[model samples]
Target chain A: MSRLFRLYEKKRGGRRTGSKTVGSFGEALFFGIFFVVGCGTMAYMLVALAWPEWRANRQFEETTCVLVGKRVGSKETAEGEPVQFRPEFALKYEAAGRAREADGVYDVTNLYSSDEAGVKSVIEQFEVGKKYPCWYDPLDPQRVVLVRGYSLWLYVSLLIPLSFIVIGGGRMIYELAHWNASEERRSVLDSAAAVDWFEAEAGERHFPNVPDGSNQTNSPGTKLAYRLPISATFGWTLFAAMAACILWNALVAGFVVMVVRDIALGEPDWVMALTLLPFAAGGVWLIVYFSRQILVATGVGPTRLEISDHPLVPGMPYEVFLSQAGRLNMRSLEVWLACDERATYHQGTDTRTEIRRVYEYRCFVREDFEIPQGLPFESRCQVQVPEGAMHSFLAIYNEVSWKLIVRGHVKGRPKFEREFQIVVHPALAGQLVS
Target chain B: MMDPRLSLMLDEPQRTFRPGELLAGQFFLEGVRPEEIRAVEVSVLWHTEGKGDEDMAVHFFERIDPDLDDVVDLRQPRRLSTVLPNSPLSYHGQIVKIRWCVRVRAFFWHGKELAAEVPFQLGAVPRPQEAPV
Candidate 1:
């Protein structure tokens, strides 16, 4: 019983490197669905093949019959009304040397045309008093047909469901035969190799104002004077999802159009259009929602962080300024200096950055303010670089930085957050010289 | 057996120098013939070492082989001098450390070599404790 439900096999060596079961639940379920659907469809094909052969080879008496009636008809389906002209073939025939009368069509398949002219053309060939060939089985004289042939459409319909069975069953067999835990160990080695490669590639990163051989490590191209816990303005993930939804809806709509065209040709496939209505409506809503988020994030202004002197030396005091303009409507405004340690590494297909704050010092705060409408405000403050602090520096995979953070709250519109980067160099002069 | 038998040392009392200061050093060879001693070179340079990637730069370098061809012993030492550059003061930090040094290398007759390094402090001065920041 324990072996039957086991999930992990005993490891022969260092790592857990063996399979505990013959097949996963998914593999079993897929194979079961495959056989159930595949066998059912194959049974239908077999019946179609056998029934035609039986009727053709059976001893049936051949006789002549006279056509008696014909007309057009209409029916209702899920998509729309399917108007087709159907011929009700009435005929008179004899069997077992006895005179008898019969009235019915030979073709059991309900083949209909959208136009009345199609049925008219077929019925016109057989006049009301004309004689046509008929076949009646001797064992059952009442079982007679004007036509005796196989239905090709019954075999054609197997193509769609058969494809699903092949895919599901093939995947299940492959999983049971060759699936193992080797890929798990390979991924571990791959991750370490990728990290080393990313470090080497990142070493060539060029920033603004950084001289080629200068003793200084600060790059002039560091755009933001500060770093944030989250980059709230980038909505790229949601935007990509919106794009995928639009593409899918386009494909589905194109399929519906083709199906609608076939319904016009008497296929009666209006149910397809009805099935697509909900997905089309939901796609429009998703497009609107994601577009709004993207526009607002890109369009809004970030409360700015300004420094009096960038690359200031330690043991020196510097001025910091914060400003915002045009309809802020903020409930709170604040600015602070923060020291951060950032580490970057590669994980699978993604490059991840981790940030931890070493310290923070608030420089200004304005929780309550009564500014007139259409007014802009600027605030100035001072922050001193500590004497023995570590200077701003960047390595391939590690960084030590100082940045100013600005935060603002508003009842309406997006809450504002921004950061500005600053570099602090060690102070010059030894104790004896001073 | 062909390795150079030489000793190099800085002549300054404190073994320290500041920006724009002229650096001076000396080296003595042990019973080496003039034909055996091929060349002598001296350089003032700075290099970084620590958790981060290391980088180095040469502020001054001179090969004295072409101008002088003479042997020297402990009684009469060869002289080396160079003026220093500004910036990049010798710094000691939590994750990185940079040091300034004068290096001497003597070239012998048959692919032989001897080298020595004399480190010195460079900066205005260390800041005092309890000073306002």
Candidate 2:
């Protein structure tokens, strides 16, 4: 016994549970279907493999026989597309001291060919006037076939169903010896859940072992606060965007350079124009896209959020400061404080995170300015936090997040939006004051 | 007939509490052998249970591993104490449910274990302005 199966058997005891054919309902259903069909096919092939000899030896007599005549004919295949040629033959044989003859082969389902050439060649080998070993049933000596030997083709045909048997039987056996029944597992901690599984790095780092009866909580700022007008998630994404632009520009530019050099060398093909067309178009698009992105990032000089206090108190009016620099015809410039509740759950094969806007405090900068191209703008606003609102929280699958949302529109430019992660603690006496 | 089960009770019966308050509880045993028991553990835990899979955090743990050779009163109730955490509290949200509970687990030899949970509310409970100072 393998180590895994031995361990399972020891746990399961010698007594079996559930179905005898399978471990689970689905597996049992599968076994019932595949096992029956696979066993049936395999049995047929095995009988077909041994049937020629089995039939020759049982209730049959052997005698001298001659291939009296033979003919070749074409017939449609099962699919009706390909045509196959079958060989019909007449055999003369003697059994019970009586002369007898039979036409065609008995119970023959094997002789098939996609091309006529193969069956034609077999007919030439089995000449019309040739004597060959044959067999006749003692009860019906007239029922005779001139050829009675095992076929190599039947041996090869067994591989089809044999594969099914190996796979289905193996699944049934493995399912019967099923392991991994423990509800708690070592892999559960890998999900970065809020568990005391010393297995997670963050869990280990945040919650540590101190002597029992200690009143000290985790040291202040052990976890770096998520600063907002922009989230850390956006920084990596912008970096990746820039990196992709550079990589693509370099590749297309190199190809263009190579093509230009080849043309200058007087060996250019006109078909190169077709290949270079997409590269040129992509080159133009990248230039435009990157320019807009860079202008939004650097030209805006980082959207800043100034909260009146570190942990904003519920029902408290907190001052918020916002600023941005750009040349724009402002359709809308607004700063919004928002709280979103997110739930992460698995649906089928996908792990989905659904976010719902639970609260919002939108404040628009009332000042209008017409500074053109490369200038600065700043504003201040206050929004009241609703009392009894859920505080910012983060658990394994659930999160209540507070963020600063910034939106602006520059004239003839794309609308810009950015979000910054911030913390909002539940109103405690001393916690609201930073 | 002596019972083999262990029951749990809170020291203070208030269902709601401010974060960082002391959450204290106790576990009473009826008919369990202290010497035969491997360990009795009490933990301050918060877990999510719902459409989202459950996630647990053990904020505090107190364990009693009694010497099997020594004689002790199995009826002596085990006391448990821990400070509540600040961030995650008792929350019932759509698709996710967060619950804070004190759990007591008793372990015996040969793959035998029993656990009981007593849930409590923690986090920001809105107090009326004129309630108190």
The most accurate candidate by lDDT is 2
Interface root mean square deviation of every model, in Å?
Answer: 11.2, 8.4
> RMSD (Cα, Å) of candidate 1?
23.3
Q: CA shift at B16, candidate 1, in angstroms?
A: 4.8
lDDT for B50 (candidate 2): 52
TM-score of chain B of each: 0.78, 0.81
Chain A accuracy as TM-score for every candidate: 0.36, 0.42
Question: What tens digits encode model 2's per-residue C-alpha lDDT throughout A163-228?
Answer: 777788777655544422211221232233336554445443321221111111122221222123
Candidate 2 collision pairs? none
DockQ of each: 0.02, 0.12
Best by DockQ: 2
The TM-score of candidate 1's chain A against the true chain A comes to 0.36
Candidate 1, residue A151: Cα displacement in angstroms equals 68
